[model samples]
Target: MENSLNSIFISLYAQRIQVLFAVIGVTITCLVLYCYRKRKPGICGNLRFSKVAYNSITVDWDRACYTTHYRVFLRKPLEGEKWRSFKTKNDTCSFTIKNLPINTNFVFSVCACNGTVQGPLCKESEVISTQNLAFKMKGISILREETLPNYIPVYDVPFRVERNGQLKVRKVTIGDYPKGGAHQVKSILFVSIPHSGHTTHLQGVMNFIFGVSTKDDFRLGFSSDITKKSDEYKNWATVYQFVEYEGGRLDKPLTLVDIPRMHGPKKEQLMMIHEQLKYILELYEQRLDCICFVGPANSNNLSPEEIDFLESIMYLFPNDQSSDLSTDISCFFTFADAGPACLENGLKSSSVKNFKSYFVNWSAFFRETNEFSDSFWNMNIKSLDNFFNHLNASKPKTLRLTLEGEPPAPQKKENVWKLQPEVKEDVANLQMTKTNGENFIDNKTKLTYNLQFFVYNGGNQTN
Candidate 1:
């Protein structure tokens, strides 16, 4: 009986050993398979998304450097939503699971593939418990260096969209007038004409005459149009024609509209300038000796004909305040054009007194002519501060037609259509190098000067 029992026990023990080995073999196979599976990143990029309530989630690898295809699988709730697994290639780094009914937690992992070859899924996908993941979102960080000043309008959108929105914005004038006007009854501010000197010169004169700005602005002018209402409370104080926009100072910000107008020609450029000068004269008409102010020589860009034409304008509106701001205004002449230079270019005849410079003493012109006063430094006159001085001494009146009051009436329709003279040539006594002195210029500069004046004065001058 003992022998038989021993045999049975031995057989059973051997069976048990075989079964244990088979189980170990299966476990090893499963471990190897898990190790070989590949996966991909479930969340992508440095950007933060808005808060939302969701179960399963996916991501895109559209950033630089990543090229391999991936398959994603979520383990449990990583933080926010309930996690779930999904499939995607390198081409499709994004996915959407159709069903995620429970609010269970999860972890996610991605599997990378190279077409024929499959890789292992990532280990321990992050937890994404729907209950634990809060719905609230954190605020995003703003890039301070990239943002514009607080005063300017700003919005969060595509760059193009933001640009369009800015274009549509209308300025809301604060503190005072939505539209401002020229302060005086008349003004004589000079606006830029073409082919003028560089901004360095113009700006220097502008600052000297206008003074440092109290507040830098796009322009100094009056309202474009104002229709006075019977109800003064409702109506504006004054209406004015639009003048040239002054533009930003040397150091300041510029708007888009200003950007082009400052550098490019506008439809109303010439007209606007004319209107500005006219407005200024109107504002300070009675306050000064002259209603007009002309910058002498224009740094030598203007030709004799051009200067003569400018003088004629003085004659055209002889009655305008610009015509006479001097004492005993008749036979106008003065020492204003005297040159103090040691070496006079002897270019005096061009600076002779005329009907426009009528206020200046005729003797002054003769003296300067004899001396050949050519340096602008010596010839400049002290500007008349307030025309009141001359106005008080001699109550000057608007110069009326001393000659044919009304020029011969226009001929007819055909005559009206004939090109009217916009600019007049200086056709007067032409002198030799003696009184007027000869024009001094090298070949290159002469051509440049000639072409420039021709465009403006049509090649004309007067002695």
Candidate 2:
């Protein structure tokens, strides 16, 4: 009986140990889950300003987990104003705060939200001041007084192809007037071969600029309806102009030029294509700020015609070896939704790789499924926003308009004038006399003398 009692005690002890181990395992799992819950949710970071204008500030951030949408807060901290909050669509990582007062400092912050629950605010916020129009006007005045005389008013001339196959430029006021009138205007040109997703890329850029996704309501200026189907003009170039304003003042004006596909099977057809391009260049005076080459992401290599077209553009606007940052040539590989492997393969083509080595101003490969889904549209829009932001920051080298057979004008070499000791002394004396209002010559004579001196010494100048 004692032995039987000992055996029962042993069995009971074993059962107790087993139960304790099961409890420990449950506790460990609970602890792990608690730690994960604490670490994973509501960690949005890297709030940054994507674009700042006279009346709007666009902010973007890294995506956060468990976020249904994001809340952006704007306030004038110095004025002690209440924080104004704007909520973005679900899963959106960027927001534009519009109609803000110009020349005023404002603070911006972002936080992730899951329904009624708010996550932690971004670790840091940015302070930005809206562009002041008075300062801008002053800068414009300075530019007009000191810079080149080629500053043509934006969108004052329109290029039209007459029925007789002649290109004509007519003076016509075009585009919408921003509330206060646009202080800055930028123009972009798109070039591509047929079946290269050029139209789709242009449409995406338009959607981003107009802040609209649908083509049904896409209109430029008063007329120029984009929704209408135009099969007859499919082979012709199209121009689009738009204006952005805030508080009845112009914020920015933008122009887009869509060149027809550069593809021709016959010699005459090729000649016609070249002639059209030449006319367009003449109309714009070759002052385009950006030139984007669009291609399909599915293509393995560029066609011979496409290669020739790219060469033509490069010849017209040769790369500026003097400065690495002055190139205006950009490349866009559209219809890239085929996944990463396909995109990589397409970029590896000999023609694409060779072109990228030289035309490296900016490049983007984006998916264009032409889908109505909000997610897809947002993704592409973000990519375009990045592209434009980069373009705006970089200064593009100026281009000279040239015809098919005419050679591009030689790049102007910077003249370095090394004056002789006697000439330098004379120049110093002249400057001092001019400043002192003594021994001053007549304005005409002085100008004539200066021109003669420069012309006589021009041969001695070094590049």
Each candidate: what lDDT?
Answer: 0.31, 0.55
lDDT for position 247 in model 1: 20
Give the C-alpha miss distance for residue 138 in model 1, angstroms.
Answer: 40
State each model's C-alpha RMSD to the native: 24.6, 23.9
TM-score of 2: 0.42
Q: After superposition, how far is residue 78 of candidate 2 from its true place, in Å?
A: 6.4
Best by TM-score: 2
Tens digit of lDDT per residue, candidate 1, span 1-463? 9999999999999999999999999899888555443322233332221221334344333332222455555544435655454556444556544334233544555555644354544454335543211110001111222333322111111111111121221121201121365322222222122333212222222222222222221111111121122342121111121121222111111111101011123223323323323432343342223332222222333343443333333333454445431212211122224333111111122332331221111122112223433232122212222232332344333323333322222223432233122112112233343335444433568778777877787667633
Model 1 residue runs over 4 Å out of place are: 1-186, 189-202, 209-302, 319-348, 351-463
Q: Residues 1-463, candidate 2, lDDT per residue (tens digit)?
A: 9999999999999999999999999999999766654543576888889887767889899999877788888888666588789999877898999887756788888888876678877764756887654322222222212222322111111222223235322112233356654366676767776666564465445434534332221111112333244666555665655443332122467666665555454344445545555555454555566777776666655544555465555445545563222344666666655344233343343232333211110112121224433445555765676667756875553454434454222222211122244357769999988876654444668868777777899746433
lDDT, model 2? 0.55
State every prediction's TM-score relative to the real structure.
0.22, 0.42
